[model samples]
Target: MSEISREILSVGDLNRAIASSLEERFDTVWVSGEISNFKAYDSGHWYFSLKDEEGQIRCVMFRGRNGQVGFMPQSGDLVEVAANLGFYVPRGDIQLTVQSMRRAGMGGLYEAFLKLKAKLAKEGLFDLQNKRPIPTHPRVIGIVTSPQAAALKDVLSTLARRAPHIPIVIYPTLVQGPDAPAGIISALKAAEKENAVDVLLLVRGGGSIEDLWAFNDEQLAYTIAQSPIPIVSGVGHETDVTIADFVADLRAPTPTGAAELAAPRRDQMLQELDAIMQALLQRVGQRVEREAQTLDQLALRLNHALPDPDRMREQISGWQKRLNQAWLVRVENWKRDQGYFQSQLEMLNPQRTLERGYAVILSKEEHAMHAVRNPKELNTKNAFEVRLAEGQVEVEFAKLGLLK
Candidate 1:
């Protein structure tokens, strides 16, 4: 009680002590800020700093909890992060570890967009199974986009150059800003109602976050998921991604890519057709030549055979008579041999010694001769019956006693 002593700590120890104190005092919190200096690790962890106008804080988002954040936060993207104040124990540095996150737009509209996207993905509306395959040879390709958009020209020119035979039916609509969502949705509906094309190209030029908001609309995502015809989304540049990219059957990096993806290249298709045609022609020619060879062989044989037709007929008739006479002589010899065998068969008959279909009664023992008369060793009634080749008869002594 009289003396006071304090242990001098190094920077790490002091930082650990402060972090431990903060952890014990404060619970988890939610923060809103613009993301900057975001970097991901090879271990699939994200390290970033969240900054408001005045202050900034470091953050870490582990891969396991990363899904809680719907879309990736771009540099300078205003975001709402649900996090907890914690200490990085090894370094004893205080940091914000995030659990859930969402983009925070003006009035948090971007946050709402992320929430809706997460919900739709969980419902499997954006699954590959739901995506339709674009027709291999679409008779008509539909373009759902702003006619005024530069992307429209890119799409038309690409399709015209790639597949000149295929016609493009443009379904013009707004491609940016708030009203663009409804306009795009209605254009798709109109295309489906008319069954105007085999597949659709939903395209737009590159833009910033706010400018591309229409492409992230949940209703539009669902519409794409349910569209009967296949859709190829080519919104923004290759680096830009939208909700439509996941819902579409195919995602193109640019508007020109969408057009080229929706139809086949004319030169490649014609080359394939020509190859197949040549193969078919070769097969037909080979078959005709084979038939001609067979006809020639048959004609030569006919020429040789028809030269002495009368003599050939006479020779065939003579051979037929000789074959018949030889057959008659063989039949007579077979009849004579059959008669001799029949006589021998009649002489060996057991029935002839007794009567027609004869029967002989024997003792219970099969080897007992009929001439043996030891009745004491035999039972004639139920145990004994004589079987002939044709029939059987039971002899009754009315006794079943065994041989004594």
Candidate 2:
């Protein structure tokens, strides 16, 4: 150019331009450094400076991004971060916006963990529909764990205390190191072959990620998924998760937890049984009372159906006097009249009705028998007596199937 011209720009404008250029010029990066001046605000944002022996840089990790970090970073902690280059226009300084972070040495292992978790999840290994129900009352419980493991002792004690009647079979195996996965598989196969236990427990105590790495093996996950008996996995502490935990039918927080889940407490089951028995007895009492009411009603109907015996006797006496007068007046006609009156008297007799399959139902109340005249006069709560031609029998209406 022949002539040079100077253009004035405001401080804010210059800073904004630089910030835009910095954001566009750099892609996301991985940085390794030691943390310094680490501060976590109430807003959940993290503000810190990452430094090495040569230089230091300002960094900010917002709440959304920082939550994914497994561990919180302290001032002296060495960290590896994946971040994007950014600039703070107000402060006129360059800074790194962290996307994810981890302890420096754990970066590779954490990455692998994430990769495997994602791959398994895509294959539907962790679906809720795939899980089998843990037995409420296992006849026999099988445990797969190291013989030397403290978890085994804890599980045994819990199962014995909760359900002493149930038997336990232990399949000892290695729970750590490179050989653990294969050993656990063998133990599981042995348990399957024996088929003595109703449910199986795969358990171990808590350990570091590296120490528990055997549980993360792909083959071990496949084995747990393929087991016919329901598997309850208790591999580590509550916070520690493994592939075995996901593949198992049920996951418990600890070995003792697994035992508690598999075995129903004897005392608790007895309490439930007692409650059911009481409820059934109460129902039976109610049913008996209702049946008595029905019988009382049927007895009242029978009372109404029968003619009064005293009234019949008085009518027979009057007829006998008439027959005696006719016999004296005409002796020849008296024989025929006598036969007709005898037949009439026999027809009116209560015993004749009883012999013809009729029964008088009486209500027994306060140790006394009373004629069941009306339903309101009888006590439905007491047993009823039926007077038949041959003998009297006491009965409850509910058992006779007459009401329903």
Candidate 3:
């Protein structure tokens, strides 16, 4: 008998080859089942078994992938997951590595959501420029919701508490069921026609996708886009999104949130107004102070420019004193000069010489007298006169000779 030839394989190598074959043979696939024995480890990895009536599969969803699921899955949750098939080397077990997950039967709703969101976005209905700004101080707030709904009560209470002074108008309508979309649109139209409210709130409570589907209606989206007044949509919880949220001017998480957004708190607004007034008063005071300082500077300049009466008087008095002193000096000088000239004149006078007993002889001829200066001019026959200081005497020049 001949020995048969066989290839030997290790456990690790077989498991690796099996894992590779499984991954390569099957493309990414989606499977639906009820979750069982779901466990979330400290490492944020989820280990669970997905089972149908007749079969079950082990699945693992890493933290990185499950974080995008938006909600945690419990053991009984009916979910669909997109996964890749693989064989675990250490345990030699078949397993699925999950990439994404969502609640079962939500596929159609999600698809519709995406389609509508894309359509509206493409038409510019969700543009920031097209959206209106929510009023910070609304005088009148309008609500569009079911009168019997619990969400209406929450909105009313919030508005009453925050802005009691603001008047509230209720446009009651259906917020659920098949006719809710049309009812909401009619209410919006009514609010527009009345034009009484400064801002409008479209509010509803949180619910499943089916329960909140009315808000995603195409006509409702169009109505919201065409509304003249600003609309705030609070259709569901924070995690829930709808077409109305995209088309409205603003979106809130809850009905109370919508009320809070539409109406400003009275106390908060009062505080803001008071602060503004204080700032304005401060600015006015500063400006007035600056003007006052400028005025004072101008006044100082003017004071310097104008003549001071007291100073001018002092200057004038000094000038007058100096002028008087100069006049007195000139007068004394003139008097002194006059006295000296008078003395000189007195010395030149012949009367003083005559008064000193000196006499002058004159010759008289043809009824005129002449001084006899030479002996030849005075003849013996001619009459002569002797002049003295007091009087003149008649005489004859009998012997006019020089006596040395």
Q: Which candidate has the top score in TM-score?
A: 3
Q: Model 2 over residues 79-136: C-alpha lDDT tens digits?
A: 8899999989999989999999977777677578778878887888888898888889
What local lDDT does model 2 show for residue 331?
Answer: 48
Kindly indicate the candidate among 1 and 3 with the higher TM-score.
Answer: 3
lDDT per residue for candidate 3 within 136-215, as digits (tens), equals 87878889988778998899889879876676778888999999999999999999998989899999998878889999
Lowest lDDT sum, 10 consecutive residues, model 2, at 364-373
Query: lDDT per prediction?
Result: 0.78, 0.82, 0.85
**Count of residue pairs whose backbone atoms collide, per candidate:** 0, 0, 1
* Tens digits of lDDT, candidate 1, 181-281: 99999999998998968999999998766778898898899899889989999998887778888889999998888988888987787578557656865
Q: Give the range where candidate 3 is weakest over 10 consecutive residues by summed lDDT.
A: 364-373
Q: By TM-score, how accurate is candidate 3?
A: 0.68
Candidate number achieving the greatest lDDT relative to the actual structure: 3
Worst lDDT run of 10 residues, candidate 1, spans 364-373
